[model samples]
Target chain A: MKTKFTRPERRLLAASCAVPITAALCTNAGAMHIMEGFLPQGHAIAWGAVCLPFVVWGLIAMRKIVAQHRKAVLLLAMMGAYAFVLSALKRPSVTGSSSHPTGTGLGAVLFGPAPMAVLGMIVLLFQAILLAHGGLTTLGANTFSMAIAGPFVSFGVYRLCRKLKVNRLVSVGIACALGDLFTYCITAAQLALAHPGEQGVLASMAEFLGVFALTQIPLAIVEGILSAIVLMMLESFAKPELREIGFLQKEVVKA
Target chain B: MSKKQVVTILILVLLCAAILIFPLMTIRDSEFGGADGQAEEVIAQIDPDYTPWAENILEPPGGETESLLFCLQTALGAIVIGFGFGYLVARKKYRAEEAV
Candidate 1:
């Protein structure tokens, strides 16, 4: 394979690879996104199986993206990195689940949901193995919530807002925020289903939902605004790239 | 620069302030737990006999250390991904301009 990487690119790659290896060597704590060994074997496997098709589809979609728009490969990789960084910046939440923005909202808005599945899964995998955050067993459940469900909702909501003629910034904000909230809701439901309390699955789900809402709601709003800001920055600085990606129509830019 | 941009920024700042303030006001005495920890507690309360089917392959020496490692890992990942993406996009632009 004739590969071309400049000196700076090689340096960047070297530094990036070194950081993870050093961090992995230093820590054993194994942080939690649903925690390690939190789920029963059966539930874990089931969720993993459920996620299989989406992942496969995402891989195919990613392949197509690379084939069709070679330039987008970088954007996709950046989106994955953005998600990892955003989600890892854990904030305290009332539900006791360390909360962070999923970053899928912005991704979905820019690249749509299917590709997000691939990007999200990659981010989760890195977090699991390198940082000891989120475990192998729970990868499926986490992937579903953060990657699949959240991005889909973001895409749906963004499109709906656009249809309703909402202001572009406002629509992006609402979509991203709602997307973050929905990720948590799905996560809570997953937990409730796995270990329903005396009140049954629905009641337990409600409990989880209520607890997460205390922190997640605010976090979602913040994420929404952040995503909107990011979008605006991209519009101003990366307008050609955005136009090429179909995120910003040429007519809209001209107008 | 634009009015809308200013409004967006203001909303973001206010929301951030609210997030910080609301927690302080309501949970002054409580130790806020992560969702994973709280979920475990809830499961135990709901079903006393419930046992985790698995355990972490490795346990860190301390919570703070674990957090440190996580931050480091994320920072590294961000740097790499950011650089790679930037390089690719810039390369594409350069190539296009050369052809033009």
Candidate 2:
């Protein structure tokens, strides 16, 4: 078995993690678009209230994953931190809806969903405490939509692709698009569930989906291509190490 | 199975259950609480001209008090469905590897 990441590549991975964290902290919508006061105080409080155990459970899970993949954990944590900060940054809209990236799919595909949930809770807590982007009540709802759902979808797609023997780039791109779309779909569902009386929930959801598709689709494609590029580069440049991490197929490499 | 494989599988299953089930167990009932449902009632009580189209979109039907039982029931159904799909994929992957 060989290692995957070259020394420089390891540094790059580490850097990728840190970059998102800083971006998340600085930009309200670094990856997710959260509008102003979209979730009510009561809603935020309710979700935030549910977020408590999730945070605790996430911390426990993170500790376990870190024991096995210290560097990966650090990088993933940074990404989660970045997501948190960005989630806190709010944009005002006439539509009275705030949206944010459900990074769960991306995170789950990379690091698995359990730790991603922890990462999301941390990010949400930070955003609520420091930036006040979202309310304390709505943390659970946000976590469920973004952190939990996103990653699980991505992971599922990736595994299915691997089994199907699809081209690596195609697999990643498809996963990215689906993952992002699912996040939005889940958010729409949540909104619907949260406020069924809103006769326009379906219409607004459709409208939001239409508006979001304009940018998100392309963004998903870009992200997918980038991830595939990085992973493929790793396959050639750092296959031996990545193989050890169970990301690459041992059979693919001609011994 | 190797220890690593066993550990990985165990964790994977646990995470899947958490992602698919926890939401159902802990999900709040009144997400639509105090927003649209009440607004509609108020509109109906007051304006009488309000159609469903103009009513606030965030509130629930029958008032702000959400049916926690309903959310949990629906969540349970969703989890079962999600798990079935996940299992199908996992089984497919396993079979493919066996063939190869």
Candidate 3:
């Protein structure tokens, strides 16, 4: 089964796998920080409103997918559980705000964004009830930002890189940056909505970019590096592991 | 992509761009986001002595459950419960379909 690949083919294969895998790992890096009541109330409510339709769509999609495979239900449920638990273990940051990784990106990359949304909603619900990291009223908002938007950004970045025929390392680096930054942008938007008396969208965006830049930019880069590293490791050592996680399939290679 | 799809994507992108630039579209830092009457009122009702008590306990010493452990346990429990329920429902449905 070991087909000898030419150098160009090897590079292409590596690029195809690394790009998406890098994004997936970056998503995983943020896996559980979706705390409730963190954003302004209005922001949370607004996002929640946005999330409702998505939830319905997501549930329909998931039911179809899960019916095809019962194990998918187990995986999604485990993912939600993972998010809830990781969120609860947050340490206090210098800003005096406790933060956790949402990890939605990671799960989304493994499964898909639609399933992740459903799973994320479940996690957010549990986080609110058990740990009080977020609130019941704000669950939809948190889910939209952390679950929906975050994964879209990660998945989008991966697909964009693939379309561009970008190099593996650089694609991963860029994808991670976008994935993390997308979450921050969503957070800023949510914050702006919930709180009143902001200067404007531009000003708030600037403020968020400015404040989060110092931390988020560096964090994004770090995540990118970690994701690249993980992809490389997966590529070289444990490719079968990637297959198990749905990163690769025998059919994709034949195509 | 189709012509209609192209238009849809353009509109969606433009809308997000608009929201990204405007903070007031989201609201501003007011009572909800600030230290104002709402916080005071909620605090007073929830725990009147919270201010002084917070000062004393801002940094608790020794022997506390880390947040990570707590999150893990919670997630594990949720997964077990959720899967258990989902499995039961799916199994029942599958059986019903078979019977029919």
The lDDT per prediction is 0.71, 0.46, 0.49
Candidates in descending DockQ order: 1, 3, 2
Which sections of candidate 2 miss by over 4 Å? A1-37, A40-57, A74-104, A198-204, A207-215, A233-241, A249-255, B1-100
- For residue B24, model 2's alpha carbon misses the true position, in angstroms, by 41
TM value for model 1:
0.79
Q: Write the per-residue lDDT of candidate 1 for residues A1-255, one digit (tens) a residue.
A: 012345664565455345334443322222126666677666676666556555655665666668766766767776777787788877765433456778888888888887787788777777676555677778878888889899989989988888787888789989999999998898888888887867899998887777665568878887888788767655544655666677778337534
With candidate 3 superimposed using the best TM-score fit, by how many Å does residue A8's alpha carbon deviate from the native?
Answer: 47
Name the TM-score of candidate 2.
0.50
The order of the candidates by lDDT, greatest first, is 1, 3, 2
Off by over 4 Å in 1: A1-32, A93-98, A250-255, B1-18, B80-100
What DockQ does every candidate get? 0.32, 0.02, 0.06
Encode model 3's per-residue lDDT on A70-126: one tens digit a residue: 545555555455445433443222222223445555445545566667777777665
In candidate 3, residue A145 scores what lDDT?
Answer: 70
Residue lDDT tens for model 2, A1-255: 122444664565455345334432312221112222344344434444443443444555566556665534434543454344333322212122223343344445555565666776556544444333333344456666566666668778987886788876567656755776676565555544444444556764554454444334433443454344434433333333344344555336622
Overlapping backbone residue pairs in candidate 1 total: 8
Best by lDDT: 1
TM-scores, each model vs. reference? 0.79, 0.50, 0.54
